[model samples]
Target: MDATKRPLRIPPQFATYAQKHELFELYRRLIARLLMEKPEDPLTFMLEELKREDDDVPAIVIQGPPASGKTTIGKMVSAKLRTAHITPQILLEDDVSPLAAKGRAIIDKNQSIPMELWVQLIQARLKLFDCIKKGWVMEGFPENREQGLALQQVGISPKHFVILDAPDTVLIERQMGKRVDPQTGDVYHTTFDYPSNSEVEKRLVEPPEGCTEAEMTQRLVLYHRHIDGLRRCYHKFTKVINADQPKADVFSQVITALSSKHRSLAPHIPRIVLLGPTGCGKSVQAALLANKYDVISVSSGQLVKEAIANESKTGEAIKPYVNRDMPVPDNLVLKLIEDRLSQIDCVTRGWVLRGFPRTREQAENLDTAGYEPNRVFYLDVPNDSVYERLTLRMTDPVTGIIYHTLYNPPHSNQIKERCQRHPEDSDDAVQKRLAAYNAYVEELSDYYQTGLHINADQDPHTVFEFVESMLVSQLPTNLDRD
Candidate 1:
């Protein structure tokens, strides 16, 4: 195993287990048989086994040195077992790359990943496990004994652990053969694994100015330390597999090891939707709920905005209403909502509908279109209070900062002061706007039969507290509390 690869370490006690190879082969055969017996129902046997024993879903940890093909093997095993693949490196790369691009000091100079990031990734995987029938294959995670113990505390225990081992000479050969483009940092080997051959050669160069041989050696040492720690902690579940063999042979060994640890669980993940009116803190609430539940927040407003900008039929119909002072037709709004709900994210994590289905026609259309909210929150602010709130709202042209005159005024008070002088609109126009909003609220109440009425007259913090309490009462038990 290339010690440079950071993943879970194998337990030391397992090093003395004389039948490690035999056990791995036996499990692989068992998994293959189970898959063949009920190919159409891969999870059926596992589910039955779990039900009989009242056991939790087993987590499998794949440990190996860098460039030992850990990810490839993990993916193959996960696919064969019909399980989700959770790779912390991939997750962190996706999350932190943008931050790095923005010049944020998030990751260390040596690209050391943070512990909280790993925790969040594990939490996300745990949430996904609730939705999936098969378990998960975690790759590039538990870099040390501490992280492994943290996962164990959260009810995640490795039913089977596989550690790939190769001689240092083999690892050095693989690492030296590694050709990385200095400009793009695109990694390539002796094969057509990357781009053009000429480009790969041109890109291959010595490490950057600061990356001396000693620094590289230290990184490799740290990786070994992590692996050694893992070996000491998870001895019972650890299995050492020789990774110097052919790719096919190595994969066969991995398959055998995973089969014996298979167990099934029911897929009872709830498809929840959060519904509320505009300016009722729906977006903010959705964000909070998404953080708490580890689900994606699919905003209908953002979808409609994109559609409108793209000038789709639904967008064209709403143009006059949005640009002019007219109200959007019910059909156009309904179509926009329908388009949003059809998105893959909405289907998976569910959605929180904000500024949609304001009228009775649109509400009925939602039912006709088969889009339903598990919970609807009616932010019940007094009509006068709402009018006061809307009138005071102002946006800074330069900074895009929103401010309210009455509650949360800007530092200068210049905008509110200027508005007082103009006293812009006629009373009739304001009345008409309020009337339209009231009618929409009434229609919403009637549409969602079990809508929770929250007193929005209180301060925003208090209102949020009330909303949180209501969410706790209505949300699924599996969801985390904010």
Candidate 2:
């Protein structure tokens, strides 16, 4: 067979291995980078990417407005990580590098360093063997969007870019109380954090002379101007830390953000689960998503009904309890769902599971089976609405389609005349089912920690539009959208 037309056959074990090691996500990131860059030497680029492993090298960026605790948090993080702390002052005062010579001349004239020169200086500094080996935490370079992009162009990327933010009022007050130790260059706020040692306290002085009120105001204006662009550039690995709290709290939050793993910039396989009360439009939303995404829609009720219709072995086992209007065993229901989800279509394209795994045990079972959903939605609707929607609805026997008399009436008289209300749609049956759902709803909610709760009390179209928007937001930030 020709190479282009050859069929791809991935070993079944590859799925288990990929899930364990996240190799699928890694490949997705590599492919996304290739498409974005379109480099000339594709083979060489792949080789370099395979060999490069600096992703966990502890490069960090701390940025904020004046007195928002960037320097304090940066120093704390560098000390905790045992990484080099690189500040702009350190770069400017350096006596060795050639760029420092040019930068010093600009500073002597009281002129700001140009963006290109600043980028070169930072690029050179980070490439030093000490920095490359021990990694580094950068404090106060790339103060604006242009500077940030310039550094990016020279391949200077930080794994974690933290933005410490506080209200202007709070920041201004902090600056008023700001104290500095000239010997150690440590910043402190008198009210929030003071020097405990008397020796340190006695020698503490006000900040250097040139940071006047006008200069501070100008700096704040410039920071606010480019804040949005900075967010856009590093949003994938960015975390905003609120700095209005105590210094210890601020430092703790920064550490937490830094220690967390960076999420993959890969499009995940759509393993979706929808949970809701009986009349919350779970099936309608699931169908809409399946149609739009070309993914399979799996429903336990539908699957059981099909099996009973075909009188298959699994269906035969479930028929007796279902015939008595009693609940089927959890294991039987789980097996049916497992068979459906393990098929080639669901495995490759993806699947949207509707109203299954209703209890905590079932949810645990699904996870143990390696079918844990990446996206879960619990649609919330008012009790009155659920009762109203369920009570007035009937199915058209000929078409097997459901409609409500007040909300979604049949257009033709013939279809309306033939509609029959299901026994399970009666008021008493719905009440019983609702009570059963209420009993375990909390358990299921607690089990799925990352599941989203959406207010689904609106029309079906509006609910679906909101759900689709959430999915679109999860796409890789670097992927181009038309």
Q: Write the per-residue lDDT of candidate 2 for residues 166-213, one digit (tens) a residue.
A: 998788777878899999999877898898999999989999752466
Worst 10 residues of 2 by lDDT: 473-482
Whole-model lDDT values for every prediction? 0.62, 0.83
Which has the greatest lDDT?
2
Model 2 global lDDT (CA atoms, 0 to 1): 0.83
Give model 2 RMSD, 1 decimal: 8.5
lDDT of 1 by residue, 1-482 (tens): 77766434332223223133344544554464464445577677655544442133446789887656677688777767656777764455444444323222355455655665566556655565432456778877787899987776554667788998887566655565555576754455564244566756766874343134444456567778788888878887688899888768998877666545433221212233444333455666667666766555665557667778999877777777778856666676677666656655555555566666667776677766766555677776665665575566766665667777677787875664443311323345556755666767766677677887877776666776776686545221221111
Model 1 residue 471 CA deviation (Å) reads: 2.7
User: What TM-score quantifies how close candidate 1 is to the native fold?
Assistant: 0.39
Regions of model 1 farther than 4 Å from truth = 1-279, 290-302, 320-324, 413-430, 440-443, 474-482
TM-score for each candidate, following the candidate numbering: 0.39, 0.59
